[model samples]
Target: MQKTGLLFGSFNPIHIGHLALANYVLEYAPFDEVWFVVSPQNPLKNSEDLAPAQHRLAMTNLAINAEPRFKSSDIEFSMPVPSYTLNTLQRLNELHPTHDFSLIIGSDNLINIDRWHNFRTLLQEHSLLVYPRPEYPIEKAVIALPKSVNVLNAPMLDISSTLIRKGLKEKKNLRFLLPAGVYDYILQHRLYQQKKE
Candidate 1:
């Protein structure tokens, strides 16, 4: 009867903000371990802009190394294209019956849940823990959600992968936003420093 909250994301560089959110869920939410499911491809995101899955996974591992309660998972790497949430959840359910999976998402994402494939089924089958995004209203967002979904007040850091990438492209310093070694890893590999020509 172990409960594990899945924090699914591309984790392009595994920033401090991402680690903070996952750590917050482990402390505040009813979960034993918080797994960062490194999605290979997201339906709403452009894969061309994504770093290689291995690099992203490596950064995630580096970022969560100090936290015993946090883990990095490459579960979605082997999954189908367009990487739908319903598919990933169903696969995880079959593979690990011992661990019950809940979803940790942001309020802004909840606003677009209707666009996700079989999103209602996802809600009925598992728990959803949502944290706030800067401009998204939790009160208004929760109104359309079901009772199983719980809203969390995790600090909404204005950090985003897109912003980080933009900073890199412009040759701006953004080393403080990432985890201890993640910034080093990104520098070593020269990821997202400029858009691929």
Candidate 2:
């Protein structure tokens, strides 16, 4: 059976860190392709701060287009708000039963898994591939992880969408932090410069 790693996030604007991390996961982990699942509504976050789902999906596609193993997923666009991983995973299984899917997430997200809806059931069934995140220590997470969970040693950068958006609002340099095409698209569309009113 083909294996696919699902990396779920808003991808407000796909950046270099996101692409780099996805590449790292594909190279070091056991998976055929890494799908960047762009969430339309993340329950833990305020949707007002998110870019439009189509724009976010487009940016993600631009960032990963050159890499065959990387894909942009808009699966959550038609799904209900405050998207639940369990529901999405269930739907994905129904849609593609032939492929085995693993959840790829950041170490920080793993720490808060208990807060996710039906997290326990999701944990029991699916394998988790975790990467390090800034300010979120991994050692404690490892102590309590399940047998199927894998903590990757991929390079952890302090980059975040918040800081990137702040830079854009302030007209600061963000050349290296974003992919060229993704950055260009953001610039062309004038995204993340001001909150949507």
**Candidate number with greatest lDDT:** 1
How high is each candidate's TM-score? 0.94, 0.93
What candidate 2 gets wrong by more than 4 Å, as runs, is 195-197
Q: What are the lDDT figures for the candidates, one per model?
A: 0.87, 0.85
lDDT string for model 2 (1-197, tens) is 77899989988777888888888878788688989999988899977668888998888888888889888778888889879999999999999888899999998988888788988788888899889988887765634777888889899887888888889888776867887687778888888786657
Q: Can you write out model 1's per-residue Cα lDDT over 1-197, one digit (the tens) per residue?
A: 88899999999877889988887888888689999999888889777779998999999999899989898888788888778888888898899999989999998889878778988888888789999999988765533778889989788898999899888889888889988888888889999877667
RMSD, every candidate, angstroms: 1.5, 1.8
TM-score of 1: 0.94
Model 2 worst lDDT window (10 residues): 137-146
